[model samples]
Target: MRGQSYVILAIIFVIIVAIFAVINVDPVEVNYLFGTGEAPLILVILFSVLMGGIITAAVGLVKMIHLQREQKSLQAENKQLKETAGENQLIDDDNNQENPDGKKNL
Candidate 1:
């Protein structure tokens, strides 16, 4: 499926990035604004990736909550419409089955 291909592509891309990072060993030093000790290249890379993932997950969670609320509202509205239609139809059926001579004619 199309989704599977996308997932495969993402995996390939991550592997490539990891391989590139490990091979090229960039000399990156991280100096925290709060006087924290400098972090090595690998640690910086991992922390950056972790922060990105956390942000992405947080955004997804917010969207999921919003979607759930919308789905719940739509389901409640559908139930109300179905009940109203059923009540109207039941009234019409009872009228049709009744006899003018006060006898059941169903």
Candidate 2:
């Protein structure tokens, strides 16, 4: 359900950008750091949107990689702790059998 809502919102946003870009079809002067050039307003708007999406995807990919690495490390730590706990339980059972009286040694 949450994913469906996101898809709907994305479609709406794309429609809005498309309408806005279509409405501004005039050529405009765009100033670049190296130089200046003339291009259609629609092209500029679309290009900006594309670049923004690329940058956002790149950032999201990096974050996902970090999370995966953290999850892997946590899983390994959890497995080690379980093994240690199992060993401690075995030792505890041995000590209980050694005590003839139903009382702990310590």
Candidate 3:
């Protein structure tokens, strides 16, 4: 199912690109800091879109890594807390079994 969804999405993307390319067939001159070149308007648009996607993905990847680290730390802290609570509970039970004379009863 995931593969099928990817295929459908790819088809839709290709159709949209094709429509954009057909509509923007004129060649445009692009001037950069070092040089200048002529490229089709569609290519420019596609390049811009690809660069934006790359940047967004990079930012999202960084955020995901940070969140994963946070999650791992939180999980470790939670386990530690549980263990401490269990130990405290056992000590509480033991103390409750004793009387106020500071000696074990029964």
In TM-score terms, which candidate is top?
Answer: 2
* Residue-level error in angstroms, candidate 3, position 83: 0.8
lDDT of each residue in 23-76, candidate 1, tens digit only: 755565566787656555766776677799799999999999999999999999
Candidate of highest lDDT: 2
- Candidate 1 clashes between residue pairs 3 or more apart in a chain or in different chains: none
Query: Each candidate's lDDT (Cα)?
Result: 0.81, 0.96, 0.90
Model 1 TM-score? 0.72
Model 2 over residues 1-106: C-alpha lDDT tens digits? Answer: 9999999999999999999999999999999999999999999999999999999999999999999999999999999999999999999887767456666665
Ordered by TM-score, highest first, the candidates read 2, 3, 1
Instruction: Show where candidate 3 strays beyond 4 Å.
Output: 1-14, 98-106
TM-score for each of the candidates: 0.72, 0.91, 0.75
Clashing pairs in 2: none
